[model samples]
Target: MEITEVSITPLEESRLKAYVNITFDEVFVIHGLRVIQGNHGMFVSMPARRLPDGSYKDIAHPITNAFRLKIQQVVLDAYKEIISENTLEKTEDQKQENVAVQ
Candidate 1:
């Protein structure tokens, strides 16, 4: 998928809003993230939290070198696999004279 547009808006006294391109012509808005420090020797994790006022929170864990590399590899592999599959599907569709309407 191609990322055609992106927007980040910081709300006054509130969380930020992020808009991302879903597909070539599709877009989506993102809820802001809430980051927090973890226990045990600076251990970090992305976890859900309940605020003191009974509100939900999205806690983003800190990124370590190992974790970052792992995540990058995972994302790369998934994207490569998806692209290969999409290319093969497109080829097959062309062979079968099947055209998708945009």
Candidate 2:
């Protein structure tokens, strides 16, 4: 019932902020969760599949709002950490590039 692990991968595309994978109690794992920047700000999207009728269906989702919020908070925190790490790496790379140019 507790979240044991969370992994986030930042992306460069628009709207989509990152991809998330979470493990519960180190036994249950869910993949393909998304961190998205929506009109209302950041939110988590559950894993979904395209239905044959041209509609999308969630493959996995929490039944309760409280549970969903918990998952979202964990995933967003991980996403923020990844974003900061990526920013630091990019800054370092830019510094190296500047040195080379000098």
Candidate 3:
């Protein structure tokens, strides 16, 4: 299976930086993955649910480390692209405001 598409929704005001959804082979889609800002750095988190014991369990995850890394890389790459685009947009808006003021 191959990752056909990745969607990112950015968030502010927390360590939870964004939410992600990835599509595989243009058919299968996984939702609710998270991009978290951790002490080490940004990382992809698998979708999980709170169990009865108040612990979290992954609802869906890759079985192999290779596949897991692939998913993480793809998700993180998409997230970074979104962030850069947003930053560029904000900078452009600032430049426009400066021009208007002048």
Model 3 off-target regions past 4 Å?
none
Model 2 segments beyond 4 Å from truth? none
Model 1 score (lDDT): 0.39
What C-alpha lDDT do the candidate models reach, one value each?
A: 0.39, 0.94, 0.96
Segments in model 1 whose C-alpha atoms lie over 4 Å from true places: 1-62, 98-102
Q: Indicate which candidate wins on TM-score.
A: 3
Give lDDT: candidate 2, residue 77.
86
lDDT of 3 at 9: 94
Each prediction's RMSD over C-alphas, in Å, is: 15.3, 1.2, 0.7
Clashes of 3: 0
Candidate with more favorable, higher lDDT: 2 or 3: 3
Model 1, residue 74: distance off in Å is 0.6
Candidate 2 residue lDDT tens string, 4-100: 9998888888999888899999999999999999999999999999999999999999999999999998899888888888899999999999999
The lDDT ranking, best first, is 3, 2, 1
Residues 11-50 of candidate 1 have per-residue lDDT tens digits of 2232211111121235632233222123422111223589
Using lDDT as the measure, name the better of candidate 1 and candidate 2: 2
lDDT of 3 by residue, 1-102 (tens): 999999999999479999999999999999999999999999999999999999999999999999999999999999999999999999999999999999
